[model samples]
Target: MRADRLVSLVLLLRRHGRMTADRLARELEVSTSTVLRDIEALSTAGVPVYAERGRHGGYALLPGFRTELTGLNHDETLALLSAGPGRGERAFGLGPALASALRKVVDALPDAHLATASDASRRLLVEPETDLLSRWPVTEDVPATTMAEVRSAVLTGRRLRLLYAATGETARWRTVDPVGVVTVRDRAYLLALRSGADRTYRMSRVLAAESLPDPAERPDEVDLDRLWRDRCARFLADGHLTVLVRVDPTRRDDLLNTAVAVRTEQPGPDGWPRLELTYQDAWHAEWALWQLGPHAEALSPPSLRTALHTRATTLANRYG
Candidate 1:
């Protein structure tokens, strides 16, 4: 409990600079006496924390007080930063500003940390098969100022007014209580409550989003991960058209990794792997078969195999 309070005290001072004992007590859900004792403990730890009394007074950290991360050696600090791509304009939509801030943070690191980070950068490289940079449409720029406001509203339990466009549709404005935001496959989505139902809209589809004054009652519980997974499962199940396929053992992993649903793998008489993969949709199966080339053979659901063969024949005709 004391350890938690001490961490809370440091974090509070870091964020708010100065807070009154009453404020700290309310935030930590502890009594004023407990907060005072925690303050004493922090002072003993050489934290340079102090408090002012009476009107216009509160707990404050001495000017220029800095917390040095002594435990994390230089290499460790650098490795941490280098381990993940810096969250950039794509996530924050701040363009050059985010890059500038990231540069500053990385540059300010100690020499050891800097070296470790440099080494890690060289050692580890992640290249997505398809470049998302090209897919992101720069023309649909939601104002950075408004985007920040929406993000804040989501964090602080507020509502937002969203101007959105569905695929092949004109933009329309609607009021939604912000629930959460999800980044899936490098695409940004806003999860919100609309018309008594939970909904998700692509951030790219949102032409504009502004925080609104009207605040809806926050839900008692928001299991966003579960909710999103359920939505995805339902969507996939509804879209899927069951198709049985026989996949060569050599290409089994490839098919398993693809976007197909409910795959069952078994060995054939020749000890080769055979797979029955359900395609969420006919179009997807047709596309997948074409991609699989010779490694996959359609086995069941006569209509699907017929369609695949027809397409393959058509392709052969065109190519030949």
Candidate 2:
């Protein structure tokens, strides 16, 4: 851990040119004393770090002394720098690592392209969690400890014990063979096998996790991309209930959030949006539409219409 902290300290000074002991301590989440000790360690280890004693003085590395990564060309470096900010590395608890890597990449670029690449990267802004419509993308909060356990199990081929809560379900304990983890739109999913059956658990819903010593049962080689696609296809092809509805323009995103998918959309006769939405089941359809109140109307599937009508009537009666 000290080694990592030392490298991070060096990278920090390299990136910012100078940082006070307090600033370094805050950045590294350690005390000022620890920062001083690390700085001494760096100096003892032949690092060219020096201190400037003054009101505005702090620790800084010697000029032009940096760790270089020379493999990337100008375009490649630009692409990485431009795309690094919005990659949602924090979702996987690798935010620090990503930041360190990007700093190294910048340090490695040729002097001719260094300024140009930094400027170019600043021009391209990507926010994966924010869409054009300004709707905040749904995200899950996963604890660092749980993520570390899951990641360890997946990487080490160990069995993972999970306390997971599925959608609309109670939390349950299960031991699984972790295949891999994937991040989509700021949400993380852990693909694993439970009792020889495929299981995909959202990282946010994982209440607790542990990496067991027992080895996992899995293939010698895995194609996670193909597995994810196949599972998604199978899920979509399952017995999902479809509903036709007309929703107010303002509440469209509210409906979209609950619906499994939007099958079709068009302008309604009343100038509202008519959408064919899919749900997991009849109850799911009723609940999702009910959340929108009068802003959404179920147009087809007599059973669903009757269900909604009955519920609305009951509510009216209660308040009448």
**Most accurate candidate by lDDT:** 2
lDDT of 1 by residue, 1-320 (tens): 56756776778888898899999999999999999988998898888888788898999999888784334444555554554454334564555665675576676777776776677777765533334335332234456676687788788887888888898888999988888777654466777888778788888778777887778555857998998887767766775776677777777666765655654667788666666677767787777777888888777678778888898799899999
Alpha-carbon lDDT, every model = 0.73, 0.88
Angstrom error at residue 317, model 2 = 12
Model 2 Cα shift for residue 283 (angstroms): 5.1
Where is model 2 poorest over a 10-residue stretch in terms of lDDT? Answer: 66-75
Assess the local accuracy of residue 202 in candidate 2 as a C-alpha lDDT between 0 and 100. Answer: 86
Q: Please identify model 2 stretches exceeding 4 Å from their true place.
A: 1-75, 128-135, 165-172, 233-240, 245-255, 263-275, 283-299, 305-320
Q: How does candidate 1 fare on TM-score?
A: 0.63
